[model samples]
Target: MTILGSHFVDFDTARILVADDDPILREFAAVHLATPTLEVEVAEDGVFALERLQQGGIDIALIDLDMPRMDGFELIERIRWDDQLKHLPIVVVTGREDMVAVDKAFAMGATSFVVKPLNWRLLSHQLAYVLRNAQAESSVRSRLHDLQRVSDLKDRVLRLSRQKLTGPLNDILDSAQTIEHLSTIPEISASLRRIAEASVALTRVHADMGEAERLTPAP
Candidate 1:
C-alpha cells in the first residue's frame, strides 16, 4: 500500500475520478495518480464526470477547466450546490495562463489545483495531501458531533435531577425535621392531637419517598 494513515478510512479502496477533455493528459493522470492502494477512473468531459460523481462511491475528483460539456468551473459550482456532493474534494487541472480562471476555480470551491504540464511529483504529493487532509477533517467533524450528543444528554439528565429529584427530596427532609420539632413540644408531647399530627406527617413522608423513587433517573 502506498499510503495508510490514522484518518480512520480504509485508504486501500479509495477511488479517484479524473476528468479532462484531452485523452493524453487523462492517460497521464490515470497512470501516475494510482498507487497500489488507489484506483483511478476517467471521465472525458465535465458532464460525464458529474454524472459519475452523482452516482456516488468516488472519494476525490480531479477536473480540467476547459471541456466540451460543462467546463470545470460549472462542474465545481454544481458540486458545491449539491448537498450530497458539496464536500467532495475537487482538484482543478488547467493549463490556461489566465490566473483569473485559477482564482475563480478556488472561489467556486475547487479544493486544490495543479497547472497543466504538471510536475508529476508535485501533483502526486498535492493529491495525497488533499486526500489525507479531507479524511482527517471528516474524522474531526464526526467526533465533534458525538461530543455534542453526549453534552446534550448530560444537560437533559441534569434538568431531570434538578426538577424531579432535588425539589421533592428537599421537601421530604423538611417534613422529617418538622415532625422531630413537633415531638419535642412540651404541651403536645403526650396529646392525642400530637399523635394524629405525627401519623399524618409520617404518611406524607412515605408518599414523598415513593414519588422521589419513581422520579429517580436510571443510569
Candidate 2:
C-alpha cells in the first residue's frame, strides 16, 4: 500500500464503509474492495456515513474530503471525538494530492490517505492493511490500559498494607523481642521467639508484595 498500513486484515469477516459525495466512486469502491469475507457499505455523504457508523459493525472507512451535511475532515474529527468510534480506521480518498489537505486529515485522526485516480488492483490491499494497523493499535492500547489498572491496584494494596498492617506488625515484633529478652523462663522465651518470628514473616510477605510489580512478568 502506498500510504500507511499494518497487519493483514481478517478475510473471514470484515465490513468497510465508504463515505463519499460521488456515487460512482462509492460504487467503485464497493465493487473492488469486496471479497467473500469482506462486505462494503456505502454512504453518499458524511452525515449518512456517520449515522451508519454509529450503528456499529464497520471495521474500516474510506472517506471523501468533500461532502454535504458533514465533510470528511469534520467526520473524522467527530469519529475520533466519539470514544466508541475513535479507534475506527479511517482512510481519506481525496480528488487532489494536496499535502495540506492530507496533513489536515491526519491531524483530524485519519488512519491514512490515498490520492485520486486510485489503483483498483491495490485498493483492497490498502484497505486490508489499514484495518490490520488499526486493530493492532487498538490491541496495544488495551494492553497498556490493563497494565495501568493492575499497577493502580497494586499501589492501592501496598498503601493499605503499610497503613493498616506494617506499623502494627512492627510493634508486635518489638514487644515480642523485648518480652523474650526480659523473660527468664525457657518455655516463655521460646513462645515469644515464635511470635516475633511469625510477625517478621508476615512483614516480609508484605514487603515482597510491594516489590512484586518489579518482578519479571510471565511470558
- Indicate which candidate wins on TM-score: 2
For model 1, how does the per-residue alpha-carbon lDDT over 65-184 read when each residue is reduced to its tens digit? 999979999999999999889888898987758688899999999998888788765676677779888888889978999988886687676556546755555565566556656676
Candidate 2 lDDT score relative to the true structure: 0.85
Clashing pairs in 1: none
The clash number for model 2 is 0
Global lDDT of each model? 0.79, 0.85
- Candidate 2: tens digits of C-alpha lDDT, residues 30-149: 777777678989999989999999999999999989899999999999999998999999999886648899999998899888888888656777887878778789899999999989
Q: 139 in model 1: Cα distance from truth in Å? A: 2.4
* Poorest 10 consecutive residues by lDDT, candidate 1: 1-10
Clashing pairs in 2: none
Which regions of candidate 1 fall more than 4 Å away from where they truly are? Answer: 1-13, 166-219
How far is 100's C-alpha from truth in model 1 (Å)?
A: 0.5
Report model 1's TM-score to 2 decimal places. 0.68
